[model samples]
Structure formats: structure tokens, C-alpha cells
Target: MPGITSPPLPAPDLIDIHCHQLSGSDHRQILSRDVHELASHPIAALDRIEALLTNRRYLSLGMHPWFIKHQTIETAFLRLKSCTHHPKILAIGECGLDKCIDTPMSVQIEVFSRQVQLSEELGKPLIIHCVRAFAELLQLKKSLAPTQPWIMHGFTGKPALAAQLIQHDCYISFGKALLQTGSQATLALQAIPLEQLFLETDAAGVSIDTIYAAAAKIRGIDPINLRRQIHSNFINVFFND
Candidate 1:
């Protein structure tokens, strides 16, 4: 085993805009429990994410919808409020609606609305989560002021859905679904404008670079250039300093 290694390929440049790297401990505990598929999982990545950001790589952080069950909703809100000021914390979620999970729709709405209020108050974007709940999320967006930016991460439904979100001024972040062969999200990917789009890994069993590679192929551009565009998109979507 002493020499059993192959040459390492260059790491593809990527910007995972909806990862869970900035949560307070209350949220970290759930990440520690849920993100087991990550080679190092959440705890180690917690330290790694801070370093990656300190080294000037990009990512966003929040309590994803799946973890909402582990703790009191009030405590999660408090944690989100407290962490939004960190220089690396560019957005207010990984929070929104998920129909695939059994977390109550009512609680999800409360948390989503609270986070939206926090985004407005803190002057950051909302990195949202939606499965089959896009209509409800859009309804909530209608009540917020027109100026607040909301970036929807892991978006992979359809071109019409993208059009609807784009019409409302919400940005969409694409992930693994677009990478899968012959998938509808891949078809949808062809329709989205680069300006209203972002990139993410979203706790999926894929690397940010792979997501970037798959996406750049769909965009017919080099991955490095795509990375820069996503970085620019991240800045524009979050509008955080």
C-alpha cells in the first residue's frame, strides 16, 4: 500500500452557494447527524468551510429544511439571527419548503417567513429550498417588498418554473439533477440565463467541482469561466459585502 496512488486531477473550481457551513451549534448538531454521506461530514467540514472562505472560496450557510425537526423552531430562528452578521455568512438560508419531508407545513411556513423577515432586516439574500412547494414559496415572496433578493437553490423542475421564478426576480441555483443524463433539469438548464442562475452542492453526494463541470458543459463554457460567472451571480444575488 506504500505506493498505491494515482495522479490527482486538478480540482474543478466551484462555488457551492447553499451549503451548511455557517450555522450556530444548535444547527451544527443536526448537520453532524444528517450529512453522513460527506466523506468528513459536517463537523470537520465546519472547520474546513471557515478555512475555505478565509482562503477566499465561496459558499453560503444555513439550517436546511430537513434538519428543522431536531430542535425548537424558536431556537433555530435565534441561531440564524445571530450568525447572519459573519463576513462569510452571505445569505439567510438553505431554509424554505420541502414537500418530500414530513416536517409540518405550518412550521416550515413560520420558519420560512421568519427567515424572510430576517433577510429583509439584515440586508442579505434568501437562499431558499423548495421541492413541490414552489407555489407557496412564490406566494410568500409576493408579500415581501420587491427589492429583497431571493435565490432558490437546487432548482431542477422545468423551464416554465424557471420563467416564473425569473419573472418574480428570484434567482435559481442548479445542482446534481442537471448533471444526470437526459434529465428534465438538464433540459431546463438550457433555458436559464446566466445572470439569474447560481451553483450549489446542497449536501448531495457530489462535489462542487463536478456540479460545476456538468453545468459548464450545459452552458458550453469552460468550468473556470463558469465559476467566475457563478461567483459574480453569488455577489449579485446576495448583495452582501
Candidate 2:
């Protein structure tokens, strides 16, 4: 860890629109691959991450698909449902479809559909975790189309896909992959209207502050200015005010 620079000062009022902090699939995904490098204690990880959030405060919670097999839907929902009332648990998810997994698409759909309904009822924005099932996912959304907002976390499709999702009135979260030079994902992000765009580090182990800096570069704006715009993007998507 020596020689590693500390996280930059957080954006002045910037929101980390998507992140995973619960003891579920995404957590185990990170820990199992590199358990020694990942944060061991949830409380300390939150505090360490919050230390970078000088001008913002909020985090999302969820049990991702890879862990869904670890618990019954009822048990998983019961645990996740209870966390909604906690202060700082600003959103619910990083949850949704994953067609590539052995888990039946039916089970994924069931859990995802239930979460969407509950999100609507609880009035919390939902951060999604979609893979190759965009069409099916969109159909599901159109059915309920919750009054609450839904953000597609870690979006990496072509501009056409981005256009399709944005047209549905769902927000998108761009990440480090989009910051790569001359990549399709990078171009796709460049094509996203500033208003419809948000940023994330996903499971990449990169800091959002770094991701934001790279995003500013991609958008040809100062970090401070991008901070303001992304703040607006966050509010437009999640803020009821």
C-alpha cells in the first residue's frame, strides 16, 4: 500500500450513484478473488470509503445474483428489506438480470421483479445489475415501471444500447471501463447526454474520485464543473426534490 496515493478530495457534493457494501455476492466476489487485499470489516470499509466522501453521503445495499443461490429468496429479501430504514442506505440494489449464469432466468426474474415492486413500494431508487437480458429486463420495467427511479449500474453497451435504456427513462452508471482510451464503451459514454449520465467504480477496485477525474477528461470539463453536473444527474435520477 506504500506508494499508493490516497483518494482525491471527493467532488463538492458529488454522489456515488452505485456501489456494493453488503455481505452478499458482490462482496464475496471481491473478497474470494483477493481476500487479503479487500477490506475485512464492513464497518471499517464504510468508514474508509466515507472518508473520501467529503461533500457527499450515501450508499446502496443489495444481495447480488451470485449470492442468491446462497440464500432463499425469502431469506435474502427479509435481510435486505430490513436495511432500507438505516441512515446512509440511500438506495437499493446492484440487483437484477444475469442470463449467463446457471441460476435459472426464472429465479433471477422472480427476485428482480420482487425487488422492483418492493422498491416502488418503499419509494427507493433501484440500481440494476443487468447482463445479456436487456430486452427481457426492459419488458419487465415497462410492466411495473416503478414510480421510483431505476439506474442501470456499470453500463457498457454501444451508443445504441445507451440510447435505448435512456429512452426508457432509466438512468445509467458509467465506470472505469468507459474511461479507457478509444474503446467502444468510452465512445458510448461520450455519446451519452450529460443529463442522462452518472458514474461508478463498480467492482473494479478503482476509486470513484479517480473515475470522476477520468470522466471529466472525457467530457472536456473541469472536475469541479463535472462534479456539479453529475450532482445534478444524481438528483434528476434519484432526488425526489
Q: lDDT per prediction? A: 0.67, 0.68
The digit string of per-residue lDDT tens for model 1 on 82-185 reads: 55566566666667899999998888888778778877787777777799999988888887654568888778788899889988988887888977887877
- Give the TM-scores of the predictions, in the order they appear: 0.75, 0.78
| Predicted candidate 2 versus true structure: per-residue lDDT over 1-241, tens digit per residue | 6798898765555455665432222111111111111133445455554454322445666656666776666765665665455445556676788987889989888888887877777777888889999999999988876787788888878889888887898888787786678766777777777887788766677767778887888878888888878777666655554
- Please give the RMSD of candidate 1 to the true structure: 9.5
Worst 10 residues of 2 by lDDT: 27-36
Off by over 4 Å in 1: 1-13, 20-53, 57-61, 222-224, 239-241
For model 2 the TM-score comes to 0.78
Cα-lDDT of candidate 1: 0.67
Judging by TM-score against the true structure, name the best candidate: 2
Cα misplacement distance, residue 120 of candidate 2 (Å):
0.6
